[model samples]
Target: MSDSTAYTESAKILLLEDDLLLAMDMEDYLLDRGHEVVGPFGRLVDALDAIPRNELAGAVVDLNLHGELSFPVIEELQARSVPIIVCTGYAELPEVKTRLQGLPLLPKPWTAHKLSSLMEETFGATQEPRDAPPSKIRN
Candidate 1:
């Protein structure tokens, strides 16, 4: 069996959602599940800045933020070979789909359970929870 404990302890997740309420809920959920939440960045610029410097295991990104397309952010994350789950309302937007191709798209109105399962599948989660609080870098 895989070492679930070690997996959870080391994985750091990036969250790039503009919705304040949703971001808070996601951050809390990820933190409760034992992973470090790198950012609940409300804007694309902040997310782009963090992605290159931070040691991210994976990312859950919203395609549209503050009425702006987040394609550049997605491209940067993809360039770094960071696994991404596109959590957005614009999943059907042909432009976005064409750009992303086969990346996982988890539509908006997501549940903690669904997000947790995705994390577990992508990066693995453990029974153990982290002691430090989840981080937030909104701008």
Candidate 2:
């Protein structure tokens, strides 16, 4: 599909996943859809550090990052009021269910179509890109 077909406007999405291959695939998909991807951070500390340094339109975060729970990342995104979609294989875990009660959960092995749809739903169709200065990580 063409990059502009799904949504007229693109967004900057933060990606936090531990699996290198999976992260690359997701980054490619987001890029193809005309969205810029922030860190596909495999480490919790790195992901946390990137948060404040970037202006994120939304986030797609895995629940686990190298055996560490990503609750802090989720909390930080929530605090910023940035939309998040938990793309996790551990959605059924008690801790995940309890902690991420209302957040959207996109189970692992997600389809591009589903991701696009959910992104549009969460962020809407016509987003005006933020006027803030470029993200430090990008430079």
Candidate 3:
């Protein structure tokens, strides 16, 4: 949890994308929202290495990094029980599809409001129309 009074709070955001401009934009946007954007990493390997260390409440991911699929990074975040938001220009593979369950997916060229709403839903900040039954994670 973060301090409510903090103007700019901290969250460990692991973003993997090769596009330098996009990476910087995401980092800045998340930071402005009072989050600690950890890596706007352009490489898959560096993003993978950093995922396990942060106290993350949420994540936003670009599905491909430097021509490599970022499924491994998603797996690591899932293992840590962090809620993740995915941004993809392409369709997800079988592995990512199966692992995602009913989580929301935001395609590329999204607005800030969409990202904010989805992330809020993940963080228990939004109330579902009907109460969702509490579920447990196996393994």
Candidate 4:
């Protein structure tokens, strides 16, 4: 595992992904980078439920959870002002383009280095883990 001393601060990051192996990979990578992993939620409902329960510095959301679209989860995160990174294997559909107009889209099959770079760019440098104050999710 890589050393965590490189970061100045750590963050609690929510992860919404349906693929078990991929989720694990991402969770491990984030943890290795010294950030707390909230959930590798495989279902949309679970991801939605997690939003209000944890204070997240950012989120990595897959465009689809199982067969269901994850737009609601994305919207909720946006409403809360939480930064987000969307990943998808499918082509950029019109809806995706519309919903994620300015948000970062991490295409599938990305490397850990790419993820690490993006995470840093999105959430800033990682640091030692710290407890975050509770935050509420807006309706």
Task: Quote model 1's TM-score.
Answer: 0.82
Q: Could you tell which candidate, 1 or 4, scores higher by lDDT?
A: 1
Inter-residue clash pairs, candidate 2:
none
User: Cα RMSDs of all predictions?
Assistant: 4.3, 7.0, 9.7, 7.4
Q: Give per-residue lDDT, candidate 4, residue 39.
A: 85
TM-scores for the candidates: 0.82, 0.81, 0.73, 0.81
What digit string (tens of lDDT, one per residue) describes model 4 on residues 1-139?
A: 0122132345678888889999988777777666767787888888889887777788899997767888999889888777888988763788668878888778898687767677778767553333543322222
Cα distance off (Å), candidate 3, residue 4: 17
User: How does model 1 fare in lDDT?
Assistant: 0.75
> Which should have the higher lDDT, number 1 or number 3?
1
Give residue 82's lDDT in candidate 4 (0 to 100). 79
Instruction: Report the C-alpha displacement of residue 21, candidate 1, in angstroms.
Output: 0.2
Worst 10 residues of 4 by lDDT: 1-10
- Candidate 2 lDDT over residue span 16-70, tens digit each: 8899999888877776666767877888888888887767788899988878889
Task: Go through the candidates in order and give the clash count of each.
Answer: 0, 0, 1, 2
Q: Deviation in angstroms for 71 in model 3?
A: 0.6
Query: For residue 6, what is the lDDT in candidate 4?
Result: 32
- Tens-place lDDT per residue, model 3, 21-113, is 877776666666556566777766777777666566676788777678778888787777767788876656777677665767877876777
How many backbone collisions does model 2 have?
0
lDDT of each: 0.75, 0.75, 0.64, 0.74
What is the Å distance of residue 66 in model 3 from its true position? 3.0
